[model samples]
Target: MENTKGISRARFLAGAAAVGLTGAVLPAGQAAATGRGHGHRGLKHRGVVYTVGAGETPGTAWSAARMRGDVRVIRDDLHADTIDVTGDGVERLTATAAEAAERGLHVWLQPTLGDVPEREILDGIAECGRFAELLRRQGASVDFSVGCEFWLFVPGIIPGATVLERVDNLRKGNVDMARMQRRLARFTAKAADVGRSVFHGRLSYAAAQDEEFEPVDWNLFDVVGIDYYSFFPQPADYVCELRRHLRWGKPLAITEFGTCAYVGAPETAGMGWDIVDYTKEPNEIKGDPVRSERTQAAYLVELLEVFESMGLYAAMAFEFVTADAPHRPDNPRYDLDLASYGITKAIKDRPDDPSSNWHWEPKEAFHAVARRYGRRAGPGGVTMAEEVRAWTGPLS
Candidate 1:
């Protein structure tokens, strides 16, 4: 597999490892942070926007406040059914949605069916169906981006068919164009199904060539959805590639995007920690933290500008919170202890044995995004300070 940024997957992995940063585990908190930027002023666009998950964290809420777009919440583990929507969950999500709605944000409910154990698939679908119904009863405008990145999880074909293939399989098995239309038809036919819209979630894989392109059944959706990381070389490259697959003319939404940052323990006990470096060729530490964050922010700004210029419908950043992986301790898929893509760091406070893993913390890129989109507060408002400063120097 190749990253959209022109780096082959193997090369990117090897390069990343050489820098002392390892592991690209999908941060659940990253996915959950998708909805945090929904309500800020000046962040307006014609696109159909959405966020990662609907966790009721302050960080998530703050992020949503800065986004001038629609909101979508992952409804799998968080609120899969009425039983899961306990008093706490209900209150939290409801408050979150209400806050978003007040800021002109539309909420969509998304559910995934394939990543879990095979035994859980049927239960997942059923849970999704019920979850959609329950949210509707609550008078919320609910929709489902059912079965996220199905292609990424499907078995068979090559042993390592890349992440894109796995996501494609997910869609094919559950809701491709033909299947999606049928499902929608049935869903519409049901007598009591009044308030929900169901769309297929097609997570884009990191394939740089057409030979690796996985076909999507775009005809079955009311809206088109994709997850983007810093895979492509530039935002323009991504936009061009995206335009090719957008034959159906439905609105498009980016399900994810962000830079990865790794953290490590301090070199000396009482001394301040040294940032992991990723500069050298043969195992030299040269991880460019500042560059990574700036690049991510610049890419998002450029991408959003292109979407606006092209009159594309929707786009959402990857997420809001800095989350930790629950299953990382035992997983041996990779070597590194931390995933560095989150905007915030997750750190455990202790005197001597403080966490050795990279802590997840907000980067300047996060603030840059907030400012550029008019999602922040105060006098200067939401201006692209970084870009402006880069171009104009100090504004006497």
Candidate 2:
């Protein structure tokens, strides 16, 4: 049900907010670890977003055992040090966080609830914070994301009851830019207050780069989380646009970044998946979209290089797997994997096909990411322990 044609999610929203208004990294003295550094020095938190279903719908449900398996693949196979466990429901977030923690992966618990009332959203965040604190107390390296793209998901900002309605509200330029900005700022400040009350770890919100509205108050967050995706006609220097976050004196993290697995997807970035017809039960490609895992792999590697050059605190690829978008090679037109940002292609379980029993298979991007993150495991690069220590720094 999510659609953002052509410009990454942030730009798409930024454009929408233009009718209305607009929208950090690193600790100091650690300048060497951040900012334009020597060849791919690597980020302390090289990560991938791991989505845990809230189990509200059948497609979103997955057992803890399967979730743990995915966590292992992310760590042992992908060679990623951090896992951004994002989803709705505190219980779901906590379960996934525990799995990531058991694997020694840095857990960024992001509770992504959409279309909910303001009070429900705040209560959900508070509950997530409590669960996250439990994980931290149990020795798991954890951070809590207060919210993700509040303007779209949080009501009262864009005057829509649902996310789609909000996006449409923006698209139609039927919003009060200044009023929305004020509401967002106040809501974010309040969210931060609620998060800090229970969660005694690093806190952040995945903010979009708005064209008109002022940036979120970084004073509320320990890390500046940007859900950055390349602007099509790709920018000359990714860092130039990214550098503004550094001025806040907080460690910067690319909360989400990546393109889909189809030809020309890199050009579209986040909106590459817009080709899928989400109106039906089984989403299908609208047109003859060519499948190209190689393109997807190259796009990710290219961005990782950019993130490396900038010396970020972390850069979590938008996602690891999209279970609902299963890979149906026999039927290319119905192959939802083409629209997926997941590095791994999920294979629907089948009793007759032994191969399908494996659950999923790695795409070219999986190995590509492994090669990039693997480089960090070498001498003079950031290790898992180091990443965790740096992320879970003295929580004050």
Candidate 3:
């Protein structure tokens, strides 16, 4: 995805104007909607939220403060402890986590999995161990798995890969549902040893009839994590799909999700619109702003309400920064220009920049949450089920 440089200021403003729909922004006290739902109560502590950004990028820290999120989710590979040897890198991450905690925010460590040119798998593990130790030393809690979409990074029967290569790669990685189960088990054990709370990140495959492709291994972690970015018009079905995963008695977290601007109605169609694409150019939904904001905000609000009502865990938005400025080319993670999803463009040091186009903003959604539920504790920390019921209404 290309940066918004060529996009004139007038065009950006037009796009924002198109999506500026009117709706009551619920306050913190009234944000939780009345819904009769039942699921396992997650950790009662306050939820940790973040906008995904480059690992340890200054933008991430700034966004956390701007959004008022309880935590900033960052890639583990970005940590100096993992990438730098002087141990100063780990110290920086620890300090960041400590600062977040002090501000009532937590830090979520996301370590990517792949063959690093400079570091071997053992080295990666050691780095992860050290990073984990740093979090512990800093008294920071909350951790999530790195990208577990091995199918995408490696090879798979997906449309992107050829059949032969996909088969070969799958065989090499043991990319079967059972293999995922085992891998998750080990990963969970490791993360638990580091922090009692953990989330396993995974991709949401095309809706399939079998559990294997559907990611049914939610039992492996305290929170069931999945990436959700739907191309369809209605989002209710996707929400239901997630609800099924929540049946595992764990909370739910969306590891990644954003509108792809370039994707057209037909898969083979050329890029008709240019925005932030996750895999390609024009990855965001560009046509309508009013419908877009309402749709997006409603989706998030509904999901948060559902999770709260069900006593499930929290969810984090996919990203905070845009792709164009200070791009990390060596990292495939930073290959695309998906930075438009950021509340603020990469250039501005401020939280909400009116200059760039945003799918969501910190002040709107962030304030809505803080106002409604900021003072109230989540199911994980609060044990008074009856009192919660009286406050938020009955849970089925």
Candidate 4:
């Protein structure tokens, strides 16, 4: 399985304690995470999302050994108890979920199919559901996601054949919201029924923060999830925005949330990755954005506090690594990593040995997450002060 990057798909696997994550989390005044409540609660699952491509690609060409190694890093180094394994291929998604489950990490199997027809997408979800049921029957903790942000991915929902075109249509007010809602209702209900027939474990749908998500019949699923992202300089009562979703009486999960590795990136939040200029020979950021790993780290910690205050069920960081976007520090314009939400920066080249290009270096966010998520909340949960006081080490 040689990838387009010319990297070998070598066989390798290691234990969780095999390697320790080193690095100090830069100071970003600790947040009062246990605010509204005296301690952290209603949040059980905490970890990072990992994605693998369907076939040969630059950073996502995953081999068995590669998948094993990455899962070890997530469980051990990152101190994540749960992993949201997502991608297009059913085999890859199931294999990765199995690996994570073997390592004692809860697996959220999400099939993200973009720019595909409705029937094909539904079929893909059904296949994933069947596989997930097999894993669960084998004693693995697995959950199935029908699909994510369908308005942007599934065709016929929006008036376009591609994701960008669909987005453009929405931007130009070309969509019929009422009709789209009705169609979404039918699609989601069918998806839930399809998944329920196969996967017996918990089920959820990763929703985008939009009106389209409003029409979903959440009772079909066990958990209400959203890939929540908003710009920085938030309002004083920002947490209240999500209160509407809580009305379903279902546990809410912040399926994805994080910012890019650059100053002012928090202001753009989810759209920060748009800084890349893809037309160039070696793609680069559009502006001279100052890289700031601390900004990304602090924003994530701050949101953890907000989500905790809201007493949500779970909150998984947007991602653990971005393989395609490699770190290029020589020139700011050439540095694609500044726009990456990955806590670990993928290194593009190694002059000393070009063969070792698969290496990555953790950003400040990695340590910050390790410190925050590393702290386990007891039955009654613990306050921010108690969590800090009980800290054992850097990655404890």
Candidate 5:
């Protein structure tokens, strides 16, 4: 049996090395923060969004991460992998929470609220609340999101009969973004109101940076979070864009930000998922020429530079490990490593026996993040007077 609390795999994720750490430093040019912005009173949100994907049930990868103890917060994601929030889903969440608590890591539970009718929207929140209570009573600090990428994940929210169509709708620019932003704001506020009744800690949704967040009522939650990804076209301008959230005054957390492990992954920037054709099993995907682990590592240096230089609230890498996607050197077609955002890579095993490599190995990105966080662990929070300002009211 695979040890739930032990590290069994040797595969590590993509390029997270400290190569050229001084490459592209951007100036976060707007006004400096007056004090620690409106993050939680005592906690600095340094965590990873650990996903429990479906591969002989969930929590295997997440549990391995919990035992590592490098991350201070655990953004245990339940929705991205599973199809529904059935009883099994709730149990998986409890297991995630138990591991987090045993390791003394704070937990941010994210449940995917699929496209249910508007009237049944609260249904999602109800499920999240139940998990929150279970985690809280178990002595783990818990945060909850109503859902992830509501417009795309949920049906009817966007004009699509299926998720792929909705994604295509977004890619084609067919969906009305302005209307979606309004819906997001309304649902976010409602989720918070309902969430407050059961869960006791911070609350914020994982929003893609591409989304329109100006209308979001920042005051409704403790922090403003963005799944901020850096594209190749925008580094200097990226700082200017990130500054937009600074106006929110609450601690703006980069909820999900990461680069993939391929060679030219950074050059392609923010398109790892699309890099490999998913029509084949993750292991059967073909690897491209542009693949360079160094390229991926370089982006880690770039983003970390921007994040530390900006002195924002907190930062979590995209994830700890991706299941099913493994590395196979002989058959490049099975190199799922190209499309993975995980800090660790899963070892390539026969499809019939994934447990052969029950554990994963570390990747270059693993050392890079550990090094960065190790540095931050020294100084702790940003200086109120010099780098960041205090929490003020939300933007007008």
Candidate 6:
């Protein structure tokens, strides 16, 4: 959950005092990415994750992308059991960047070089370089995340081969922080080496929100990145807790954060996505949207307040759209929408229209976030019920 567990759709890794490096070592084949053109020094990063596949996206908007977000975290060329970044995949990857660049948005390209095998990881990074070059040519501001949680997702990066196995191992107390940190440091440095060869831009990996991230030397990347989630029972202390991360002295970004759609969803904010039964049909699932969606909307407002008050560099909403569980007509029992953390709901594609495919309609949280980014709170300085209840959607 960073889908809240920092791993959902992690389908999700570690390291310790493995600290600063003497010199930035650019991985082979991508020396040019480390060149002088990189810059993202001052940016507020009002971002939304655009989960993308080849040329298709997890969700598309009804008319056009609303000006709600400034930074578009394009999840490009990522791989899982059924996903692999092939030639076509790379094209799919750059295509989203082209669209984002056209919208005048800063782009954070996260390319999942396939898990395990050294060659696959290298091949993935090379393609990311190619994609990065394509994005830069489009005049889009770009930052590169070598990988997400690699320790668990990628094979051979840690002791366990699969995510479940690794999670189990961690639970059973098999984690070796020192060994894990050393491996991650080597791998990230390697990625930097290769990444700099072609795409010269800001680079950083999306680390987990957990303490396992301690080994990473934040100084290696341009911006200190972390996929944070409100896994805690009460989010009231979020601002206070952030002091630890800000101590890194580098610009910080909440690469990921969001709450699911459900009445008691906030309690499971960190890993709600995992609680759903993906095998079920969306329409068949049913829940009280009024209570659930409102809860999600309120959660968004609370988090933004923390970000603004804390003065963090930037924060990206966990996601803009989710395709796994989309909004559909009738039925509610199997509704995947209830379990999603997307700010917008995915409406099925029009079967009759040729020009349009699908659409993502804004949730109440969308307006709430837009209001926060404007440096103002919802309606009355900041609202939970009113801001959400104002909407006329199914959830409202």
Alpha carbon deviation, residue 78, candidate 2 (Å): 0.8
TM-score of 3: 0.48
1 or 2, greater by TM-score: 2
Error of 3 at 42 (Å): 8.6
**Tens digit per residue, CA lDDT, model 6, 1-396:** 122222234234212111111111212231222111213222256666655432223233212243223223222211000111111134455655555666566777776544357667766777877686677776767777776666655666666766556666665667676887788778777776777777777776777665434356777777767766654445456654555565555666677778777676666535555455435632234435433666677777677666655555556776766644556555465456666777777666752232345656767666666655544432345444445555666442
lDDT of each residue in 270-352, candidate 4, tens digit only: 56776777678667679678788877877777777667656677788977777766787776776777877788887866522
Query: TM-scores of the models, in the given order?
Result: 0.49, 0.83, 0.48, 0.82, 0.72, 0.71
lDDT against the true structure, per candidate, is 0.34, 0.73, 0.33, 0.68, 0.53, 0.55
Error of 2 at 125 (Å): 1.1
Q: What is the lDDT of candidate 3?
A: 0.33
Q: Could you tell me the TM-score of candidate 2? A: 0.83
Residue-by-residue lDDT tens digits, candidate 3, 108-211: 54443332221232244345445545555666453534333333222222212432333344335434546644654454344334433222222111111123
> Model 1 compared with the native: what TM-score?
0.49
On lDDT, the leading prediction is 2
A best-first ranking of the candidates according to their lDDT comes to: 2, 4, 6, 5, 1, 3
* RMSD value for candidate 1: 13.1
Candidate 1 shows a clash count of 54
List RMSD in Å for every model shown: 13.1, 8.0, 13.1, 9.5, 10.2, 9.9
Off by over 4 Å in 3: 1-95, 102-104, 113-122, 144-146, 154-220, 230-239, 247-251, 256-295, 323-339, 344-363, 372-396
In candidate 4, stretches whose alpha carbon ends up further than 4 angstroms from where it belongs are 1-42, 54-60, 212-214, 232-236, 350-356, 377-396
- What is candidate 5's CA lDDT for residue 343? 72
Q: Local error of candidate 1 at 136, Å? A: 4.1
**In model 5, where do residues sit more than 4 Å from their true spots?**
1-43, 56-88, 115-121, 133-139, 211-215, 232-237, 280-287, 351-358, 377-396
Misplaced by over 4 Å in model 6 are: 1-43, 54-88, 133-139, 160-165, 168-177, 231-236, 278-291, 349-358, 374-396
